[model samples]
Target chain A: MRFKNVFSIIGPPMVGPSSSHTAGAVRIGRVARQLLGTIPNKAAIKLYGSFAETYQGHGTDLALAAGLLDYDTDDARIRHSLEDAWSSGMEISFSLGVGHVPHPNTARVALWAGERYAEIVGASIGGGNIMIHEMNGFDVQCTGEFPTLVLLHGDFPGVLSGITHVLSEDGVNIGYMDVDRKARNGEAMTVIEADTKITAATQLKIQQLPHMIKSSIIDLTLRS
Target chain B: MKYRFLHELAAAGQQQAKTISQIMLEEEIAESGQTEEHIFGQMADYYQIMKDAVNKGLTTNTQSKSGLTGGDAQRVQAFSANHEPSSGEPASTAMAYALAVSEVNASMGRIIATPTAGSCGIIPGVFVSAQERFGWSDEHMVRGLFCAGAIGYVIANNSFISGAEGGCQAEVGSAIGMAAGAMVELRGGTVDQAVHAVGLALKNSLGLICDPVGGLVEIPCIVRNGFGAVTALAAADMALAGVRSIIPSDEVINVMLEVGSAMPSKHRETAQGGLAQTPTGRKIMENLKKRK
Candidate 1:
């Protein structure tokens, strides 16, 4: 069922020695950048399990750096992403984590850009596929396969309805959704994967909803 | 919208009076909710990428970043041009092209992951070389890719396609099966034959381990792709000649899953055992670590 599209099996033209390490790492970084709404001035990446074991040989480091720089998976510039990051004033660092993780190919990326900061934990699940499992300390789940909206809001009544109402009003069909919170009446996160593209205008409308603390759209389809 | 197993796919193709390629295309359209033109166009673009990767690797002295693999594709091509290859022109050319794309991958050049990057070269190797020999148009190659995709889809969902999950057999073995099935279709074989080719190719690749030297995808990974393409070609030829697998294709795939799961963790891309633990492979790792 995961291999729904023929292209998922046949293609995804990429620069790679390994799809999970290279292309999937790029996607994880790209998602982090998108969540931050821009290329971060500083990024701290932690590779877990197999990603930690064979990252250098597979160019996982370069691919992650390139992703933070907004490079596509197939971009030839991925080979020189480290230099590019240094030249562009984007500080990036990597560390290997020795601990139990849900998946072997896991990476936790923390990004900082002036006053804005975001942390995302994701896993490269193979064949260039990824799943973002944690964001901003909230346990959420989403695959970057569709145009997704990740939102943080106060855990209050009507907050979820308010957001879903805006999306439904805009005629966006939700394909998959996950909601997680730390505690009752505390901070909460909602991740929405939509079948149709969520326009910038719709995102703005959702952002303006009451109790909305932060909102970011990670539309991977735009990468071409 | 999709067939979950090879038998199901074969049945659907037969019941619909369609080729496996057509059945796969229709399933894709249904699952993705995309128009036929849009999907076909995207596939055409992927085919171009595959061809480009093969061309770039064959024409250039591409070296991997680790310096572990490079220029073998060109060397093979040169040797083929100078002497009569024992494998014949088609097989030799396929081997060269497979090496080319895999070398390109190791060098961080653009290429399609037919199922996964470690096995990326097999489809393009067989497809491009066969295209050159048969003068098949890009459109025909695209259809062949759909056939390959169908086989890959089943294997990926049922068994595995990543070395970490199931060792090299899951990666390279699945690629060989996919390429063989697609070749059968491209050669105008029946759906049954195509499915049989998947079994034939996979049966030979059973128990293959994934132990890359120095943890890079350069050592056995690249050369395995070259040999995989040859196996795929032979499997297709056997299937077309009315040879069938005594064990069904689905059973073969299930056996692959069992075998791969029973394989040791060290042999599954960990670079800890098998060839990766040999003296030469250990030396390569030591050298790479010292350079770092």
Candidate 2:
């Protein structure tokens, strides 16, 4: 693997009850907010398997709430997330789902900001590391350990080429890309994972393209 | 049945009596200290002395602010009652909050950083319980500690302690297992029973998330240590009573591994899931960032 063993402790020490439940949840929530392109007006998250069974004990509920509100992992406000959520009038619920093949601590977060909507599914790999498994029914993957780009563009022959071209022109290097199809003629999802920065101008240009539904840039630089 | 339990338990307790200090020494081998063998020998000696202290009933039960007390009981009641820790009482209602400040400092000073600083309370909790309950010879308790060390080694090798990798299963889960196994040995349980106890304690908290608000390990992390300590004792007690788990230790370890792999990154320690996403959570982060 290009990354270190998922369990290796490479850097400074961490604060934890468990890295996945607390830190990973916080980052996932933050990523979900990024994918929604704004703080979620409301979010409904369902945790499958172990996450649902032990969410409260492990602080998963609080971490998810913190993530939706756009809190970073180290944000002290995370302690008060439940109270904040209750006061904010956000609807949050947890459910156990049947996803055996995916990671053990899988979670699906659906975010709504007025008219805008997005969903993300991700997993904690280990050692405060995470893998964003999918976004909006697309087979997307990113470590959330680096600065990443989650772009939703129209399905076209030249879409990938256009994205890479613009990125290359802007001095951004492509790390990885995944594409998922909803239909032959309907809207499709494209997730581009990159090692470089995705500027505001690039995001705007990409969204302006025909067939583009939404565009989001998620930065996971400090989260990993 | 009574004889069988006592025999099995005593045999298990004696299995690793001399090895606990050996393991602690080995854990510190790579650090900047004396030679590896020297450190190992020193740890072994310390283990023996500590064990002897227990045998002599010389434990200092100093009632350090970090010791488990009434607060632990209240937290257990709250968890069983499925009530959240009262966030309303920040500094006043609970004495442990004041103690938490000192506990963090003591952990930084006395205990070796095994996985995390926030989880420092577990080992001490185990030692204190052993001192109070059995008052066993230092050798016996030291062996018990060694047995716990073996369990920790297995967990470290098979899984991870990073919340990001496997959520809290790797951190608190593993810690609970270690404490339970250690307690089993001290209490004269067989190694198999020790393993079973460790597994049960771990399974109880499997998939627990590591969501520290604002990424600090203070809030839930501090309190969870007390719980892990008590649970470890409970697990050891169950094992001593011949309450075997349907699943073997190996199988339970496997389950933990699989469950951890399946956890989402957000659910780890990224502060992205659970409480990190709430409006108040966001505001807290924003406020902290602003302060920074």
Candidate 3:
């Protein structure tokens, strides 16, 4: 493993009653927004276990809603996210999810803006760090710890090769990669954790590749 | 060897005959691919943020929406300022500052989650109070943070730092231990003394549950930060006086993990038991829900 940045352990300045509940929820919502490609017109936040039990007190609800608007973790506006959502006409709802969740601190944010939609499932794994375990019903893994590219494509040969070729040509180093499919030769999602920023041109090039259905870039290069 | 475990960090410091802060700074430089000046500069920003949080918390009287908390930080500050604290000015001041930060966190004010938000108070509490007494330089606080971060990293990767996963022992417990070690380093104690301070501070926090009344970070959490700061001071003082811990630092961490694992789910951050289940606690929860 590459060196774990000491800053990862030291701090992430944020508004909080709880890091796992508030800060982590903000990151998940931010990723959901990124995947959606626009400020969400509507969002359905389903929380499980501890999140469901104590989200209100921890400000987890407000944090998630604020995050969908790309609010930073320390934003004071987070406290009024629900009201803001209402006033902004961003329809939002929260529900107690009683189903499979990998961790106790789990949230499934379903979001949409116009024609674009994204379903993001993430776990707040303590200390405000999070792992986006699932996206759009596809079992993929990403932490948003680094710049990441999530590509939806047809599961076939050359899809991964073609994407990596573009990244390689652009001088982007792949830190980690995972490809998940529903079945042997079906739709797939590929997650690439990038060591360097995936330039706008690089992302466009990857999206333009044959068999690429959708591509989303989640930038964690800058620690917010 | 990598700085993944407490033993590795200790061994690296021993082999190079460097202080814990020195080893940590070198490791940070290697991991971040940045210059030491940059890291120090970033630390300065964090220091300023911490100071800002303390100051904001001390002055803010705005109550949280939940109506359960706010204003205790100011009360503590007032008490310390108006009278002579038998524990002395420095420790009392630290407690006040720590309470202020924790109060800030409880009220959803911006704060640096040092390791985690639930335990955010102890670091600033100790550092600011120590600064009030000794007036250490900005560089010294940065070094102390490096030392503190190193200790927290070991525990976080090896065991857990989430209250929901390992209870308050992992949350506040880790913060207090980290603060104690950092206090030692800032005061010019050796690496071994810093480790000893961590051990002393951690041992007593073991088996502590994470039960906040009404599932809020107020109630016990804010006041507990004051005690945690005091504990760090005591441990640092003992280590500086050449006190030795019978249990090694790594073993103490293991002990804390064991205790957290043995605890029931209700005892964690679920808020289903402990003080959270008391009659008054239940009333508070009901009132909060009614307001919502």
Q: Best candidate, DockQ-wise?
A: 1
Please estimate how well model 2 matches the true structure, expressed as its whole-model Cα lDDT: 0.59
* lDDT score for candidate 1 against the true structure: 0.90
Q: Give the TM-score of candidate 2.
A: 0.49
> Would you list the clashing residue pairs of candidate 1?
none
Sort candidate 2 into its docking category. Answer: incorrect
| Count of clashes in candidate 3 | 0
| C-alpha positional error of residue A24 in candidate 3 after TM-score superposition, expressed in Å | 0.9
Q: Report the C-alpha lDDT of model 1 over A94-177, residue by residue, as the tens digit.
A: 998877777778999999999999999999866787888899899898888888999999999999899889988999988889
Cα displacement (angstroms), candidate 3, residue A79, comes to: 1.9
Give lDDT tens digits, candidate 1, residues B1-292.
4588999988887888788899999988876778999999999999999999999998886898888889999999999999999999889999999999999999888999889899999999999999999999999999999999999999988888888878899889999999999999998999999999999999999999989998898889999999999999999999999999989999999998899889887888878899999999999999999999
Q: How well is candidate 2 docked (DockQ)?
A: 0.05
TM-score of candidate 3 relative to the true fold: 0.95
Of the pair 2 and 3, which is ahead by TM-score?
Answer: 3
Q: Could you tell me which 10 consecutive residues in candidate 1 chain A have the lowest summed lDDT?
A: A1-10
lDDT of 2 by residue, B1-292 (tens): 1111222333444575533324444444432234765634444564443233222222222122222222332333345346444432211112222223214322222222223334545654566445555556654554455455556556655676655556667776776777777777666555667767876887798768766556544445666765676677678888889888777665677788799878776776656777766787667656755663
Off by over 4 Å in 1: none
lDDT of each: 0.90, 0.59, 0.86
Better of 2 and 3 by DockQ: 3
Report lDDT (Cα) of residue B178, candidate 3: 95
